[model samples]
Structures are given as C-alpha cells and as structure tokens.
Target: MNLLDKFDAVTVEADFRITPEDKAFCEAHQAAYDAAIQSFHELAFFWEDMENTQKELLGSKEDTYLSSRDGPEISQRRINAHLEWLHRAVISNIVYHFNSTYHVSVRDDYVANNLLPQMPDLRIYENKEAREAYHKKLREAKIRYEDVFDQMLLLLDGRSFTEQAFHELAEKCHKAAWNLYQNKANYERKKALISFNGYFCSLHHYSWQDEWTLEDKTQDILRGVAHYETGSFDVYPLGFSELLGYQRSPNNEHEFSTCKKVKGLKMFKNGRVDIRFTSETYAAEFATRYLGLVC
Candidate 1:
C-alpha cells in the first residue's frame, strides 16, 4: 500500500484497548491544550494592540511643523499611554496564564525572566502611591509563580537533554531577553552619568542657590531634571551626585565654595554658573570620585 493507505490500514487494524478512564484523561489533556492555545491568542492580540499604539505615537510626530510648540507635550501624553498599555499587557499575560492549568511552566518562565526583572521600575509613570500599588501586585505575582519558575530553571540547566529541546530553547530566549534588558540599562546609566556634568553647569546659572544643598527639595529637582534629560525615572540623580563626592554641608545647609580658585573663568558668573567648568576643578573632582580617574 501507499504511505497514506498504509497509515490508514494500520489505524484500522489497531487493537488498542481504550478504557473509559483513558478516554477521559485524553479529553482533559485536549481541553487543557485548547485553553493554553486560547491564552496565547489573547496575548497575540495584546501585542498587536501595543504595536499599533506605538506606531500611532511615532506617526503623530510627523506633523512637527504644525505643533512645534505643543509637540513635546502631545508626544509625552502618547508615550505615557503606550507605557500604560504595555504594563497592562504584561499583567494580562501573567494573569491569564496564572489561571490556566496547563503550560504553567510558560507562565513561570515569563514572570521570572520578564516581569520580575522589570518590577519596581516598569516604566510606568504613575505617582509614588500608584507605583507602590503596582509593586505590591508584582510581588504577589512573583510569590505565586516563583516555585514553578525555580523548578523550570533547574530542569533547563541539566547537562543531558534528549527530550528537553523545547525547554532549552525557552531558557535561551529568556537569557537573550535578559541580556537585551541589561544592555539597555547600561546604556541609560552611561548617558545619565555623562549628562550630569552639563546639568551641574546649568545649576550654577539658575541663581536659585549659591551652593547646592542635598535637601529633599534639591533631590526632587535633580530627579525632575534628570528625567527631562535622560527620559529615565529609574536612576536616582541624588545618588549619582553623592557618588561624585558632592556631599551636603556639615550643617545640612548650603555653604560657600571651598575648592581652590583656578586661574581661568569662575565657576559662577553674574550669579549664574559657567558651562566651561566642565573641564575645570569641578570636572576633576567628579572624574576622580564618579569615574574613578586619578586625575
């Protein structure tokens, strides 16, 4: 017989003794598989929607000439909306799979590799209170799936994998995603550090304070400026300043400058700071402390 006919003949001649319990088990497995597929379809739809929103936001910038003054504000609103949608997409994926009986490993892998890494700083621009609420939710989700995630991670780490190719692939994908995230984080940190010198120069020109104090209000202002410059809300600007040896005065108040005077331009002019000091004594101090440069 031909291949198709031989397969059919074999099926017809099969004397498989199927019991009622075996049939029930097969049906249950099929049902679970169907549910898993459906969950994936829903995730696909969420991703498509997210991509469309991002595209629309990018397209909105095409009319830059018309809305030159309001362009940034409009772009920011769209960006916030996109971030909110992304947060919802992640939460939806986790919730859907968490409720599923099958493919628990997939859910665990996603949470451990993707969601947990981004927790506490998921790019959501909510207020401190709102961010805390989301953090609580994330913590609960992690607790729920952490055991399964650990089990799967251990299983995927085995040296011999004859039938675990799929698990291996999942591990590789997770690692790649994590690496991409780390690279992005490194890029942001570098950019933020580079911009700090410029921001310090600008601060000298403000006439707001003769000497910068490390107060809560100062920290908040620095945070806002850093956010404006780098589009990063994750890094603490004050922490960067501390790393540069810019400590608060002993009395926790602003004080006059103590560094020895250089021959060139004064760091501050007309009650404002000069930008050129980026290469002067201040820059030397910053490099020595922040960049670990001996000079």
Candidate 2:
C-alpha cells in the first residue's frame, strides 16, 4: 500500500511513538500552532519593554522592589516559537513568581514580611573577598532602585508621602498580585491534564510529526473551535478531567453549555482552569455535544 494507506495501519496507544525527529517536528509545529493562537513569545519582548520602562521610571527603586523575573530574554520568529517557549516559561513562571512575587505559588505557603531582622535565606559561600564584593554590588542595586522608586512616585503627582495614594497603589499591587497568583495556579492545574494527547495521537504525522508538550492558556482560544462562538450562552470550564467525562463536583452542572461542544482545551503548566465562550451558539453546542458523545 502507498504511504497514505499506512495511516489506517497505525493505532492509537502507548506502543505507538514517533522518532526523536518526529517528536521534535510535532513540538515545533505545535509551537507554531500555539503561536498562531497565542502571542506568547511576544510576551518576552513585552515583558522586556515593561522591565525597561519600569526601570527607567523607577531607577532608584530596584532594590526596594524586586521587579525582575529571573529568566533570560527570548525572541521568537513567529507564533510557533512563542508557543514552544510558552510551555517552558509558564512552568518556570509558576515557580519563579511564587518565590519571587507571591508566597502562595505552592499550596499553604505564602510570602510576606516577617518579624526577623535577618536577610532572606539566600546563602553564598566563597572567599570573604567575594562575599564582600557581592554584598557591595547588591547594596548598590538597592540604593539605585530605592532612589528610582522615590523619583517615580514623586513624578506620580508627588503623592509618595500621602496615605491615600499609598493605600490605593498598595491595594492595586495586592490585587494584581492576587490575580497573578491565581493565573499561575490555573495554568499549573491545566498543565497537569492530558487531553490534546488524544488529538496528538489521532493526528500522528510521524513522517512530518512534531512532538508537542503543551501548557495552554485560554487568553487565545483555538480557531475552528467553540471558544470564539457567538450567539446566546455562557461557558465555564468545570475541570480538565471533565473532558474525559470525569466529574469532581456537583458544580459541574452549572457550567454553561455555550461553546463547549467544539471547545478548545487550554492547558497550563500550573493547576488552574477557566472558560472562554464562543461567538456562535449552535457550533458551540455541536462541539460540546460531539466531544461528550465521542468521549
């Protein structure tokens, strides 16, 4: 039989696998696929721009506020590269942000100022000279950032000393931080899921296959899926296991049937899930029903 006929011979199971090249191809293509939907790599530049702008604005506040997320900058050729990097970035981000920004990156633990006068538990051992030199460098950074923040706040209408302004900005920071924490969790939760693997198995393009390990964020809904559906409906994702027909709570019934019929599953590296509705109601229903029936 010709190569096309070989498609029928393949079966979907653990026994089936692609070569490393095929895996790489799938990863590459899936990255491209993700990029087409979500501008993840663009975030690298976006974050860089943000960092630069913030730094320039808060030149002295660097030490007072840890504004940097520790990762080398990245640039992507297209959406594909962005998508590929997104998977790595989100997981890294979930870890980084929790330790760097919020205490709740992990369960139970949270970040907050403590009563101790001791510095953070960061330890470095080397020659006394090296330790001294490192401390000096860090001190300089703190001074510069503190001064920068002073200048920036002063520039923000000279309200740096005002209690109301402090309260407002503090509230904003807390809210933004909370939102960031939840978003990371949502990503982590979805990332733990396994669904697209079903599609991945079905769409095995071993000859042209690209291995993809995806952690999707729903900011970009899949095209041709119910995420963008219009007309009447509201959608809420109950859970990932729900897709395979697993129900963990009675709350699942309240999940609006708006665009699920053909909904695209968004996965994240951390463990959180939310929903995006579609523009078309019937198509959405069709997608949700079809997947339910098929699954």
Candidate 3:
C-alpha cells in the first residue's frame, strides 16, 4: 500500500473513539488539512511531469535533436538528472508534509486538550494498578501519535527523508509516466494529459520556490549547519561566510577553508542533527569564541 493508504489505516485504528472534542479539534486545524491537500496535489502534478519528461526522452530516437553544447549523451544525462531531482523534490514534499501533516495536527491537538484531561478519571479500570495500566495505555497512545508527528516534522523540515515511501512514490511516478506515454488511444491520452495539467494549473498560483528563502536567518543558519555536517546543502544564504566563516583563500585559489575556529565544537558527516538545539548552541558558541578572538 502507498503512504496515504498506510496513513489512513493507522488513522482508522487511532480513531477508535471519536468524541465531539475530536470533531472540534479537526475543525480548528482545518488549515493544516488544507495545506496537506495542496501539497499532495503538487506532488501528483510533479509526478506527471517527471513521467512525461521520461516518455519524451525515451520516445526520441535521434541523437541530433537531443544534442547540446556538450554532446547528445551529456545533454541526455543532464535532462535525466533534472528529472530525477524533480522526482526527489516531489517525493520529499509528499512524504514530509502532504501525507501526514494534518493528521498529526489533529491527533496531537485532540490528545493534548481532550484525551489528556481525562487521564485522571479511571472509570475504564477498577483498582489502583488497573488505573495505572490504563494511564500507561493513554500515554503510550500519545507517544505513538507524537512519534509519527515528530518523524513527519523532521522530514518536512528537510532533516530527514522517508526512504521506503520515497522509493514507492518514485516507482509510481515512473510507472504512470510510462503507461501514459505508451498509450495508443488518443482520447485516453488527451483525457489523462488534461487531468494532469489541470492539477498543475490549480497550484500554479502558488510559487513553491518561495517556500525556501535565503533571507530567513533561522533557515540560513540551519541549512548552513546541515551543509557543514552532511555536505548536503540548499540555496539558502547562497554563502556561509558570515555565519560559518567559510571562504576561499587567494593563495590556494582552489581550496576553501574557515577563517576562525570555535572550541568545544564537533562536526559530523552523517546522522541528522536536531536543528532547534544544534543551531542555537552553534550560534552561541561561535559568537562567544568570535568575541574572545576580537578581545
């Protein structure tokens, strides 16, 4: 099953007892649901785009038309790289935000305000030990909700990716693209293309690129730290000289290095860092050491 199916199944299990409070919680968090729907629609649109690009590339037999300034093979490789990047971006958005954001919000909000308040009342159980067990069950349920919520938050924030879900999405996009491309029925092709383009147009009013901003200080620092830790970076800040002192030296002309060093600082090559804690600590430590250098 796809991520959405799995999400729905878990939700069904999680929704064993739905009260008026739950309904109110969902209503309060309608914006989150709207965001998720928008995200999913974008994901579907990009999936079609990726598939159509692949189909076009595959359908072409002549190398002359595909040739660029580099060569036909190089040009083709670039196109493939772009298509792959597009697929990854779409999958990232879906796995991170589209699939679970609203559900997580609803679950968390419901538990916090509704279910948690009833924890003290143990009519579900008789003795003290039984009451404790019931409380434990409630806590466990909350944790389950939080665990998935945090995981999705991490994914959406670009701290991690759901590998299995991503692969599944990629496969689905490829299959759909191929099927549509290979379809000989003109009417069917026209219908499918229209549907695909319609979804894309629906979201065309919003610029996805605006979601990533270099001017956002918090994002810039977090992205810089992520790059420093993992070598995987985004376009944020465009440079890291101010925050990380990363600059190229004229003497070397080919090598880049930091201008200053901070003590008690450790860096990693793999594993995700908690952006909230790491970014704050890194900034404070750097500022302290920077002042020490100046003094």
Compared with the true structure, the alpha-carbon lDDT of candidate 2 equals 0.31
The reply for model 1, stretches above 4 Å from the true place, is 1-14, 59-295
lDDT of 2 by residue, 113-229 (tens): 111122333454356666655443332221111222233333333222232222232233222222343332111112212132211111112464322222222222221122223
lDDT of 1 by residue, 161-193 (tens): 221322222222222222243332110122112
lDDT string, candidate 3, 143-200, tens digits: 2232333444443333123332332332333232223444321111111011111111
State, as a TM-score between 0 and 1, how close model 2 is to the true structure.
0.18
In model 3, what are the clashing residue pairs, if there are any?
Answer: none
Best-fitting candidate, scored by lDDT = 1
**TM-score for every candidate vs. truth?**
0.17, 0.18, 0.16
Decoy 3 TM-score against native: 0.16
Clashes per model (N, Cα, C within 3 A): 2, 48, 0
How many residue-pair clashes does candidate 2 contain?
Answer: 48
Candidates ranked by TM-score: 2, 1, 3
Better of 1 and 2 by TM-score: 2
